[model samples]
Target chain A: MTPLDFVVSLALISVAAGVLGSLVGLGGGVVIVPVLTIFYGVNIRLAIGASIVSVIATSSGAAAAYVRERMTNLRAGMFLEVATTTGALSGAYLATLLPERFLFAFFGVVLAYSSVITYRKRHEDQLLAVSNDRIANYFNLHGSYYDEAEGREITYKVSGTKLGLVLMYIAGLVSALLGIGSGALKVPAMDGAMHLPMKVSTATSNFMIGVTAAASAGVYFIRGQIDPIIAAPVAAGVLLGATFGARVLGRITSRTIRLLFVGVLVVISLEMLQKGLFP
Target chain B: MMTRQSPGPDPQKNVTPEGDLQVSGRHRNLSPAQVAAMEEKIRKIEFAISLVLRVGVILSVSVIAIGLGVMFYHHGDYTSITGHASYKTLTSRSTPFPHSLGQLRRSLVHGDGRGIVVLGVFLLILTPILRVAVGVVSFFYEKDVPMALVTLFVLVVLIASFFLAGL
Candidate 1:
């Protein structure tokens, strides 16, 4: 294909990924990197750089709506950001040192792990007979939000503060290393480990991903991974697709589409793993 | 959905009347005016963030799209991609295209499409940092000193890493 054709195709794929990702509650960055690297023969580093930029774009795009709705817990996001940012620093530093093959393998494994986590829904903790720890109280980790679906204000207390911090550190690390937003890990940490409600966990994770991705995005820029030709289209396409996807998300309830998306992720994961293992 | 009465500590202690007004985790005696002002403050902050994000994305996309158009218009072929814009060629640089701030400025002034694309990506990256900066001010406006400090700390890390990436 011609260069123009190549660029346009990548952009179109990004738009499709963004649409499916937002609909399935996955971010487009994950889908973009593998497509660019495996299909288009773009260098993995350059693909990752573009993916990271797309991640930030989509995060900021979605976050504006969430923040306006008062669904995002600002304190929780900021508090966890400390760990994610620091971890992102270390991860980016390591990215420059790691071998390309190893990076590819790591991405594959992380993708598989993320897919499994995505398949399982987190059940809300029912035991309210719990006590608040001092650190949580001091940091004011607890929050309440008006759930439009339930039509009531739901108040939830946060627990396992220490675990959440440690997990967030890992999430940040993985984010920079792979050049994808680690929302997959962050949401579970907040929802399952910290006992936050699903809506709060999703919103807070969205709020935090931008900051976490930003911490490493700068590093990628200086490292020269961000090819404007690749990054510009990827970012623009994903933002457009994600915005459109979010709008359509509420209207559709297609279980088959969701399952098909997961199947595609699995296939992509295997492709990445094969590339890494062989090359 | 389980709202058990926490007989733990006084909810009053948990609720800082000044800093914790926005959060409804614990009950606090707040006046209607206080709530309205807080809501207004939040609405303003959200509006600011929304504007920053939307403008940044739109501006960047427009510039990059224009750059692509110019690249296609002037070259009229895939020669640049084959010759200089290949993955192998682009990846050889130790820093991103345009190399330095001065170089970027010069190229942008010359209306070089590549430079414009770089600037667009740079703006997209900046959107999050800008939002975080706005967050610090909004947190302070809410009288949430601790959260503001936390946000400030995140901002510091962001900037520090950007410069440190030079090393």
Candidate 2:
């Protein structure tokens, strides 16, 4: 293809990636990796390298709006980073050593498990509270939220701190390995296990995933996994798209966006399974 | 064919807030001694984590820059995968390392479905190892027994899944 043709094709795909990523609260890498690997016939390593750049773009763009709205739990995000960054580095090394088939099959299982989690929690959007351990209160993990529906800023403590960290660690690892942002696991873990509000968790997860991705993305980059020709446009496009998504957050109900998120995950999971077993 | 917003960061405003500046996990108050102790511990940990993050970010950027640099430095002389532009043919006609790297890249970028399928599987196995490390890191830092045990569980599941998949 001509350079112009390549630019146009990439531009079109970039826009689509940004829009979809913003909508689902995901960095575009998951979708990008697949399309590059399968349809475009791009190598997985190059795709991951490009995807990491995109991940930074989407996360940085979205994080700004979330912080402005006071939705992001910055403290929680910072606290969790201690775990994720370390995980990301190790994940990259493992990816380099392991063969490709094993990676795909493993990803397939994760996809299936993620499907079940999404399926089980399809409904119910209430914030439940429980007692926190000494650490939760000691760390000031409690906060108030202005629930638009209830017309009040409800005060609540973050429960299940232990559970949330465990999941965040997993989220970081999967994110590094699969080039996904891991908001799918991070958000739910924060919300259901930790009993943090959905809005708060989503915003926090967005803030955190980049650091996680960066940690591992760095390793991949060093080992020569990323390609700039792809990473540049992809990152730039995703950053723009994520900005738009963050802007649209309150304009529409989160429930609408969430169902769409689940649907996308379902499709991704099925695709992974099919490819893993068949290929 | 689609783009994701790639959710993340921009530096915060210069102005400081009246209360806890960031306000995610700030507790109400503590005695001077308690605060000092917590501050010390948190500080120590934060520096380590920050070092890791900075290294990661720097390394990731450098890699991409190198790739771009290589492409540009060779631009006028660059070859495609096919025809007169064929990088493969040029490499075949050229010397050793570039030829092999090009071949590896060709298999990586444009190989069959089976190649990508294998890559995906590798990503999968690698995740658990990564995840377990994360869990252990957090557990040790936080010293939370429950979280540490749960990390073990995730580790087990990851291992079990890998073996079950016959990998």
Candidate 3:
């Protein structure tokens, strides 16, 4: 493809990835990096730079609605941001040290792990029944949100605050290292460990991702990893696609949709592993 | 140190048919004064958060879109001169453009499409930082001293990373 064609193709593919990602709640960065690296034969660093920008784009766009609706737990999100941002900085520095093969392998492993976890938990929506911890209680890391579909308010108390913080650090590390938003990890940290409702966890995760991504994105920007030619189309496409996805999210029954995307992720993960092992 | 009962997954049982759910969800059984204060504070903070996110995304996407369009329009000129249409050649063959903030601004002032795209991505990065900054102020206003400090600390680390990138 010509450079113009390559750029346009990336944008169109990113739009599809964004749509599928939002539909499955995974964000476009996961798919974009692989497609750019494996399919388009773009340099991995450039792909990562573009993917990270797209993550930030989708986050900021979706966050406006989530925060405005109060579905996002701002206090919890901000509290967690401390750990995530710090971890992101560390990860960004580490990314500079790791070789391309290691980065690819790590990305593949994380993707496979995420797909499996998402698969196993696909049907499980039961909130964790853990007693509130002292740290969580002290921080008031508990809240409620109204579910429009259910048409009622669901109040929840967050627990496992220390565990959640630790997991968030890992999530931030993976986010910067892999150039994805790490929502797959953050959602589980909030939902599985912290006992937040699924809706709240997803919304809060979306809210926090932009901060985590920004921490590393700044480093990447300064390091000159971010290519504006690549980033522009990807950002615009993901933003538009995510916006469309958000509109249809509440209307769709997400189980089948989630499973289908998990399949896609599995394939992509394998491709990443093959590339890493071969290259 | 107020303690509120946690509602279950099935929200129907916790809420009354008479619409107590709205009241409960809105204030978590706080007193009238506390509820009023919390609502006002939440309203103000949410407005700020939403405004920041909306403006940031809109402005950045618009700038990037325009930049992409300009780059597409000039594709012939760029490819004709360079004899190739690959991103690597365009970006890496030259000394690579806009290594610093000053360079980006100067290029943007000259209506360079790539520079504008860089500025757009830069703005996109700034949105979350702005959100964190807003979080600090909102938390302080809510009298949540610890969270305000937490956000401030995060912001510092973020900026520190930017400087530390050189190392």
* Residues A49-76, model 1: lDDT tens digits: 8778777766666664554455566677
Q: Write the residue-wise lDDT of candidate 3 on A122-148 in tens digits.
A: 774555333437666556566765666
Best by TM-score: 3
Assess the local accuracy of residue A163 in candidate 2 as a C-alpha lDDT between 0 and 100.
75
Give residue B111's error in model 3 in angstroms.
2.5
Residue pairs with backbone atoms closer than 3 Å in model 3 (clashes): none
Clashes of 1: 0
Report residue B97 deviation for candidate 1 (angstroms): 3.5
Off by over 4 Å in 2: A96-103, A145-156, B1-167
Order of quality (DockQ): 3, 1, 2
Give TM per candidate: 0.81, 0.62, 0.83
For model 2, state the Cα shift of residue A37 in Å: 1.8
- Choose 1 or 3, whichever is better by TM-score: 3
Pairs with steric clashes in candidate 1: none
What's the TM-score of chain B for every model shown? 0.71, 0.40, 0.70
Query: Lowest summed-lDDT stretch of 10 residues in model 1 chain A?
Result: A122-131
Q: Tell me model 2's lDDT, rounded to 2 decimals.
A: 0.53
lDDT: worst 10-residue window of model 3 chain A: A123-132
**How does model 1 score on DockQ?**
0.33
